[model samples]
Target: MSQKPSKSTAPEAENAAATRGTRLFLGLSCFLAGAAMMIIEICAYRLLAPFFGNSVYTWTALIGVILIAFSAGGYLGGHLADRKMALDLLGWLLSGSAVLTFFIPALHTVFAAGLSAQGLIAGPVIISLLLFAVPGILLGAVSPAAVRFYSLTLKDTHVGAAAGTISMLGSLGSFVGTFLSGFFLLSTFGVRSIFFGTAALLLVLAVAAFLLAKNTLRQQAPVILSGLFAFFMSWMTAPKPKPGVIFEHESFYHHIEVSERTDGDVTRRVLQLDSTMEGGMDAKTGDLILPYQQYWKLALLREPAKVGSALFIGAGAFGMPENVSREFPEAAVDVVEIDPQVIEVGRKFFKLDEHPRVKAHAGDARRYLLQSGGKKWDMIFGDAYNGIRQIPPHLATQEFYQQIADHLEPKGVFIMNIIAAITGPKAELTSGMLATVRKVFPHVEVFAVGYRRDETQNVILMASREDLKPLIQDRYVQQGSWQESLIKTHVPKGTVPHASYVFTDDHNPVDAIIARGLLE
Candidate 1:
């Protein structure tokens, strides 16, 4: 042992060391590839949200398609690895994934915009497949390839153990990536930047893989050039807003934008979340331009004496809050909006800061109500929605209405703004919400803001523990106003047909119900 080793022994020792190095490299590659797959899957939700909406259907399509693609890729990869465990192929797969991942931002805009014209059902599925399938397949293949390569470095008896270790490592990497992308990366960086960072990471992994395989520079040149070219194309094709977009922001919750358009002498500024116009106002007079806002006055009319303290569940542009504060100057208005960015946009562009008595709190409305230390209110308004068409499922459930009831005074009124047609198939949401509210309140009345029965309109549901008939008459006789006239003219006479189904936390089919409503 003290003497120099023989030439044959020296070569064996060098080979053993090189084999260990190759094993370590392959393990790392598998881990990184697993992480990249999850990152892309999670980010896909945000990328498609602005166009297809962050709905249950969209998520179902995305997760289902990606899983199917992964299954196929894993089978194909194992087959290829059995025939020949080549390092160059692994390098090519990673390089190709990086290039495709780089193009995601640009591809999302083009595909989503084009497919959306086909309708919600077809659009979301087609867009998800087109954007995520190839990258998911490529990433899925890496794990199988790595398993085969690692087994080659080990004894035949230990192959099973090596395969298990590789799988566990890949799973661990996926777990880490999920938390990091959701908790850190999404919060700190923009969507486009997240994609860019992912692409860069994969590029590094590709280069390392090629080097570990001892490939020549000529062999790696094509991969490097393709990545560079893809990056350049993506940068050049990035999305830009159309004319008249004043402000645009992407929050953890929503894709928000403010745009002003002039029609004749009136300049209307609108707040849009996702694809729907949440709120709008006349720029000149600061008056609420949306027709549904006029119906919020029904809450005041229903409880004139108890209008001192009011709570607004959803503060879109603070239009309803502003209107309420102006109408009842002595009232203390508390607005609980879930998104802080929306609150900021409200104060900056929607004149929310002008009201001295109005205060905005950023949190979920139901959670805030439950934890507000027994603070009771005269009027509780629920305008919480995902878009104009979809009410957040939690806000539409029976337990939520009970919370609303508990937060209100003994004679207080709760007004909710809902979108539904008066009759036909579109009435399910209205019917279900009415049934849920009636479970908590003694008196519930429905008032349609617009007179049209055929079109989808904003239907206001006024609920209270006491009889609202006397209060409505009292307010009408006192004011003798146009609001009273509008209320009398538009309020539907008959009861809702599908009032049998009540939405609960465990069984809320709001999305499916809304989809059926739209289809009919």
Candidate 2:
């Protein structure tokens, strides 16, 4: 109390101000670091989808691997930050993650295709580890590093305040990042462009961190140069487009592609959703080219004596609707497809035209059926699927089959295209689907496309209110005449293994059933 403390000199005061400024930048880095982590996580699924499918298994593997990376990074990062300058560590981490993210667009296919060759069960796990682990670890380290740096800048050392503020900033950034990626970034800019943007943001943060570490602009120039160089190299390494692919896109739903291939006299244009061949037609005949679709011709032959109107769910390539419009020129046909881009692709490459009789609606098939008030069709077809292995669960339940039945005329028919095994280890999906459909429509029949009961193949299931067993007795219908050859593929109801359960909306395990089927 005898003497007052001396006031700080101008340089010391200026330095104190600089430290406060650096602390603010440190908080900004934490926010961005959180944003970067989420962006990478969301986009990572799209990276794997074109190959491994957007299955629940793929989702589980990615989430698990990323959490593991974050945990390890947090532990190691705290140790490093205690021993070294956190701002310096954060700078290095941001730079490293930036470089790795830069390379993702060019190199993801190589990793995905390689490990996916290992088969479905273990492939996604191994590939996710290889492709996502390091970037996640590096980005994960940023939080603790920033935490320590912020603590060092304070005089009283309020550890709880430092952590809470940093965590809140990161959490807020996470909320922003999730909405940004899901709502805007992916749908607008696409996945690869988002990755490029994320990389650039990280590079900027890296530079800011170094500059705040008392580094000269000259000292940080090389990092700027290296980031530039890496992007250029990565751009050069991007894979070339595949042959026969006329158009391609990353829709919110699937990686859709259209390609043309000729076999002998037939030139076929095919619409592929992910790895599944959902639609195709002959170039000249404009007729359906794939065999499964050929099964749809039974629509006109079997149930309705005359077709005036038809409703087709899941307009793959618009093949069936186009077929119906051509079959009965006066018939009004409505095709419902979930992906508008797929509908766009149908128009662009699949010859989906402006026919007055054919109307294409972009929306979910189930909702469309629910909204229909007293509208009935002579024939209703369900040609939708999630992939080769499974149908969309909501589309396969007893309630959905009831909707199909309710929307049909008294003599109308419902046809479903199913890819499943008949009587072997992988037969659960087929048994469950058949059992569920039979509950709503008493007359049920099936035709395995390849006529092999034990193998997984396209099984065309037919249901109607009218008795269909009589068709087998009709000579012309079964005479190997018009649709008689299709009769040869008939799967008698007794041959189908009885399932212990039926699929309902609340209890549907269609995806899980397929996953287990794949393992077997």
Give the Cα lDDT of each candidate.
0.81, 0.82
Cα lDDT tens digits, model 1, 1-520, are 4998687998899999999998888888888888888888887887887777667877888898889888988987788788877787788778989999999888886778877664556677898788889888888888888888888888555888788988988998898889888887776777788888899899889988898878988989988998888888888888888688999887777778999999887789999888878888887767888877776676656534337888999887788888888878999999999989899999888888788889999999878987897899888888887653357788888899999999888878898888887676778878888888898998988877766765577788899988876655444453567566555744544656657788999999988877677666
TM-scores of the models, in the order given: 0.93, 0.92
RMSD of candidate 2 to the truth, in angstroms, is: 3.1
**Candidate 2 global TM-score:** 0.92
240-324: candidate 2 lDDT, tens digit per residue: 7779988878877777888998988888998888778888888667788777887666666664446888999998888878887
Best by TM-score: 1
Error of 1 at 403 (Å): 0.6
Please report, as a residue range, the 10-residue window in candidate 1 with the lowest summed lDDT.
471-480
